[model samples]
Target chain A: MSKNEETEKSDVKDSTAAFEEALAKTKDKKYVLHLYVAGMGPKSIQAIDNIKRIFDEYLPGKYQLEVIDIYQNPVFAREGQIVAAPTLIKELPPPLRKLIGSMSDTERVLLGMDLISKPNENDEKQQE
Target chain B: MIEEKDRTLKEKSLEKAPTGINGLDDITYGGLPKGRTTLVYGSAGSGKTLMAMEFLVKGAQKYGEPGVFMAFEETAEDLAENFASLGFDLDGMESRDRLLVDHVHIDKSEIEETGEYDLEGLFIRLGLAIDSIGAKRVALDTLEVLFSGFQNEAILRSELRRLFRWLKDRGVTAIVTGERGEASLTRYGLEEYVADCVILLDNRMEEQISTRRLRIIKYRGSKHGTNEYPFLIEEDGISVLPITSLSLEHEVSTERISTGISRLDTMLGGQGYYRGTTVLVSGTAGTGKTSFAAQFCKAACERGERCLYFAFEESPDQITRNMKSIGIKLQPYLDSGLMQIHASRPMAYGLEMHLMGMRKILDTFNPDVIVIDPITNLISAGTEIDVKLMLTRLIDYLKLKNITAICTSLVQRESTEGINAQEISSLMDTWINLRFFESNNERNRGISVVKARGMAHSNQIREYMLTNHGIEIRDVYLGPSGGLLMGSSRDIQEAKETAEIAAQSKNAARRKRELESKLKSLDAQITALNSEFEVQKEELDKLSSEEALRSNALAKDRSEMARIRRADLH
Candidate 1:
């Protein structure tokens, strides 16, 4: 191929990659979140901590988390319809999901967030 | 554009909250449709605050629906304390995050809303509180306090409408309490029209008797109890006794109880009275009306049944002492918890207040038999019609509970000839008459069984005596004498006099019988002499015949000679 033709083709490829990146960014899954706390208390702190840990672990690259304190920001807590302490809402996913209690169960949290598929006994047996 | 979609989506997603008040729920049917606003309007001390707090507390505790209470009249602490007396643990609920109590101290002078400002500020605060606990119920206790801060009715009216709209938009069941206006429900007159339901509470006194009544003025999409139901507020909260339509299907008890007097019981068809019956004993003054009622109470207590004696004429101590003279000791029964003596003057308070007091005491005591001595005294507090209506309501109430009630009425001396109190006679299960009669120049008391429902009672009037021992009913005394004495003492005197006269006449007859026996002996002697004289005459005649025979023989000889001569001649 001619050197000029090669350069143009490369340029076209670059433009196409840039367009695709833009499209991907536009269509990137949002992290719709809900935080439920019962007023300002230590238990609320623990719930926020556990949710932050889970978000960092499974959705580090692409996720937006909204912190909802029922006491200081009760309006959002009511709007999100939080009834109990330490409730998490995942809104970014096509279908919204909720995780109640302190997000201690990593597998359950990941499953609730649709980050990982449920593990199978056969896969574990093969690994063993 | 996004806000519009969000708004539609929110409207579609909201769910209704349930309030557990009985009649109130019936009016609103399934409760204020989850997130709608209901206005409760009433005058001062009309139970608006208490009702609002009750709704909020009930929602949080009963239905797992958290609630927010915003009070403009009372401070948060004061409201909590007031509810605490009613056994509502507002502080505990607050601690559990199930309830939020906010005392919005609105100084009308400080607030300045000149232009169109979104009540979002107030909505945001309410939303924050509701969102904090996901409260499903909200109560704004007394909007009038806030409206009072504003001068212009137009501004207040529009603001109230917007507030109600905002609450409806949020899909939260809200109760707005308001102070009653002189002419309308609220001074602004906007809440009654805008709200989905309106309830009016009234505290009124008739003839000095005070009663709390509740009424539902308007409900949009549901049917409700339209009558004003009597309610009471105590330590437990508010209770409304909805008057059920009178039907003849109420259960009747055939059990009989003694009237404490055997003769009286015999007059009542060999049984005292039917259970759950009302007996009215009416008569002139000093005719043993109170004694008869006391006897009933005594009999009831003896049967191990509790009795409540409401004496409007006499005090408890005086009644107890008076009953003691008639051989009925009520003090021991009172001490044993089997009898309660409630004594209050007729004019001590208004008639409705008295009724309320009686109702309160009845509820607390729950007696099997209730005795009101001299119900006529209650008339002093109200008009004749008021007394009749009050008694009617009281009778209906007591009958509904299946309680045996006895009411005594005092009739004027002359009025006893006619219906003593015609208004109450038809309602009474039994009527007993006690009267004063004069016989043989003496005063006496007579008791007659006039009428007893479902029982055959004696028609003859019986004499009764009140002695230190007890009331003694005597039998009918049939005497040949023209006049009869009524009092026991006079009857005893007449019997003595009649006995003395009969004893003297019997003695004179005994003497006459002795004289007659002597006369018969003398007459027998005279008859014997006459028989001897006759025998003598017969013997003389015989002698005369012999002599005559001799003479005749002689005469015959002579005559024969003469006859021979005569024969020869013939």
Candidate 2:
């Protein structure tokens, strides 16, 4: 847990430079993410690994991720209103978002994190 | 619920965890099966959330059993604020460690499920909450929300099954709610998973009026009420009415009470209505139904017993003022707190709501007798069948409490016999029917006892007037045609009867005088005959004397001789 906290603190500090340079752009915005899980379950580990791999490939050292084990810190579970394990909350973006389940699908995770915009034409087609 | 716990244990039968909800425990026989998960499903606005919350609240406050409310749709704060109006101190219960409210936020719009994930977080949170308060009751309101949050239906189903088992294994009674579906009790068929008990709530609209009904679809291994019972979402909380046909097991009393009208009492077997029995006073409009009911209440208050008056048409002040004209002093009883007058327009609420409101008042007032003035006005609240059902329940409740009930009903037509009273007359112990007699260009009121159980009551229809002094029940007057007469017609008939009797007596006196005069004339004729006979005898004697004088000289001797010869002095 301490190691995870150190990496989270360092990542925020490291992303501050790009945040200052590209203040108006959405690309270089510092991402603060909270991943709530239930103990050291297999899904929790897989979710952590999957999101880390995505962070390394897309915005390395530009995101801060803190994994919360709701079993150990149940208060956070209530405060966060977490119902499903492996829930990821993106707090830094203008519009907050919450994504649940294993973070294996990189495209959906990116879409959920506001790293990519939704395809509006597909949405309209579905509506039609 | 509290009364049957020891019995259930002694009988080695299914134990129950009482929900403490009004009328719910009674219908469930005891309560929901203990340490089991019961599913409650309903459509939106059908009061599923409120019912589930009440179970927890009541368990915590009344049963000394801490509860955990794990809401899947609403936030804890929202739930607390929502129920605050219902007098449920959710936040207070939480602060006092008697209750724990956990909201599991599920947003389908924000979730993406890529791989396998169990609902272990919800389980852990629930467990932690339970452990914190040692909760004996748990409420997972609308747990079906997990279906929307997760894409794996199979996983959700399996986890739900396992969650119910866990709840049972922990020996904590739990209530799981689901959204109603077109084909099943719930959209996701949650009833299939938590199948120990299932209750369905339905809100139906008929004639632009809405009524909430509850039904126990199944209670595994336990006997329960299977009929759809009308329930009300009252000011305080939900109250289910289990007022079906209860067994005829209520205790009976031989005690009788007065009807306030002495002659009316004479009409009711000369002893009035039996204690703890139902009396119905039915009549046409302006036949004094309200006055009859008020007199009953006055009589109760005079006995120093509490009375509750439910006036569906008139305001309390109006009734008090109107009754004052009839010389019934209701104000003193009201002031002394022996009588409570609750007046409301029947159309203001549904039948179930009115029943529940009356029930609440009944509990608080705990009166010995109750008067429902103009109960026919309640027909505006529901249909005839609904009104009948509502009154049945009310009467059953009153009987159980040994509370004598006098209900007044207004008949639409004088010839039809009060339809409202007729519908419920079978449940009443005594029925007093008042009708308007239209005769002599005037309308008069007549009261009669149509039926009184367990007593020989007068079947005669007596005319009653709402005099300034009070209700005066007059002697029954029979017309020449043997029909009941009233008002000016009765007075006219009585006067004519008296005149005929007087004429008969006068003719008898004239015959007696004529017979006396005939007897006096017959006596005078006999006296005259006697006098004439005496004169004849005197004349004969004078002739004989003259003859005798002519021959006097010789006759002196002859007379003596004749006298001697004529008669021997013997």
Candidate 3:
């Protein structure tokens, strides 16, 4: 387990160093979140994977994610009074938010998590 | 799994969960309504939580049904430790997956309530726990404080309502405890919302002594006792004395046991007290209340049945020492484990406490007969109503158990009255009153049957002496009037009666001799009159013959007519 930790730590160091090189190229906002699930069921795992894939593709090392299983540590959900899981609690970028239900829906999850906004049809028409 | 008969018995389209407390099941006919929440509201220290916890623990252990306990007031560890004295190993049950203790912590300081929230988290956690163990019973201990302390009242009430409905839908027997309200069942007055059954617990102090009482306020579809039953919360958990609500369906016994004294037994309808009946030995001081009670205990022990003697006025040693003088050896019975003497001052505890203590001993010792010496002194602990209620409950319990009980009460020596005229007597099946009869300037013990139900007991008040042979029934001598005679007066009266009877017989003999002489003289006079009648007949015969001869001589001469006439006359 210690070796695994060491390898993961070195991998994080490499990713951070590369991200620093790329961050000098573009400007983006950091994303911080906490995801609560019932247990490591297939749906929960899928939700975790979907969110992680989205984060990796869009935010890269700019985001921090913490996943908690309500089955194992229900205290978080109890303390937060979270109604449902897989719930994504956004605790960054000024306003706290909650995105409940399946996280597999990327567009809805992004919109609900304040990652994206609906485009205005009139503005698009005016642009065209 | 439900049995066929039980399902048919409660065939009200609703399942029932049995709470395995003694006498409790009998009152509920089984237990609380199943698959629904039961509201158990009570004041502080009323054993509401204990009742709920016992329901869960007993359901898990005895009925083979797993349970989940959601304790809101006390933490899981503290609850576990508190219930450990009841011999419930919560940790063990948890390890077995038969129980789950979830402590829902709701500290307002640690909470950040910013937006709309629900106990959806609680529902989720509780649902998951119940599913994990396949639980059948659920207990939410002290839920009132948690909800009232929550920031949002509407959310709390709505969520609690939803929680109860969810539990009902999930098919779990749930118990929800609440703090007693001044004018309502629960502090929130939410009793009208959910729950198929409601029970109320009361812990009150009367005259500086405390008592715990339980009552079943409502059961939706079942028959239940409505009496305020006395309950005790000890190391063994909560025990409700539902026996007070028995329906007189207890079977009676025709068997009669002795009263250690043969004479006393004879006085009790030629046999003794009826088995399973309550007998009251009411008397004044020095009227041998304890002595008579000891005789009964000894008799019970002699039959190899356990007897419990509650001596409120005398210590067990003192009773033993005092009874030994009356030839009642209680030590032997105590040694043989057939007798137990529980002595406590009546002033030491209230009437309810005394009742619970007796009930506690009743359960532990399982005595066949119980003797309570001087129950009158318990009057000091409570009102007359309280004492009467306490004794009625106790007697009801004993009768329901088919346990014969003897109770002694001390009245004023001069008055020799009851606690209430005919109050205790009417409640008892037999009432024997002993009084000190002052005769010839000496006090004598006289016992009489005030009332013995369904039996013909002697109405004569017999003066008895308590010697080393116990109580001896002496033949009562009636005084010149109607009073009972005893002591030297009785001896003197007996001797005088003998002398009077002898003198009266002698006078009767002399009168009989004089009447016989009078009869002899009358018979002699009748015999003399018979002899004179015989002599007169013979003289008449001689006179008639001489006249006939003279008439015949005259007839031969001048006038034979006279002779013929005389001959004709002859």
Proportion of true contacts reproduced by candidate 1:
0.04
Better of 2 and 3 by TM-score: 2
Clash statistics: count for each candidate: 17, 0, 1
Q: Alpha carbon lDDT of residue B424, candidate 1?
A: 85
Q: Which residue ranges in model 2 land beyond 4 Å of their true spot?
A: A1-35, A39-41, A60-68, A71-76, A89-97, A114-128, B1-13, B416-422, B519-570
TM-score of each: 0.65, 0.84, 0.72
Candidate 2 residue B40 Cα shift, in angstroms, is 1.2
Comparing to the true complex, what docking class would candidate 3 get?
incorrect
Query: Per-residue error at B172 for model 3, in Å?
Result: 1.4
User: lDDT (0-100) at residue B375 of candidate 3?
Assistant: 75
Total backbone clashes of candidate 3, pairs 3 or more residues apart or in separate chains: 1
* Candidate order, DockQ descending: 2, 3, 1
Which 10 residues in a row give candidate 1 chain B its minimum summed lDDT? B112-121
On lDDT, the stronger of 2 and 3 is 2
Candidate 1 residue lDDT tens string, B318-398: 999998987888899999999999998888776656776888789899999999888878878766665676677778878
Residue-level lDDT of model 3, residues B1-570, one tens digit each, is 469777777676656799887667877778888888888889988888889999998998899989999887888899889989899999999999989998876554333333334455677777877888999999888777567445667777787788778988998999989888888677667864577888899988877777778888888877888888777776677777664455667788888877777877788888888899998888877889899888888888888889998888888999999999988889999988899999898888667667777787899999999988877777777767667777777787888898988889888645545434337777789888888878679888888888888778888888888999787878879887977788788888899999999999999999989888888888888899889888998899989999998888776654466575665533
Q: Which sections of candidate 3 miss by over 4 Å?
A: A1-128, B1-12, B300-305, B349-353, B363-368, B378-386, B413-422, B498-570
User: Candidate 1 or 2, higher TM-score?
Assistant: 2
lDDT of 2 by residue, B326-370 (tens): 999899999999999999988898988888889889999999999
DockQ of 3: 0.07
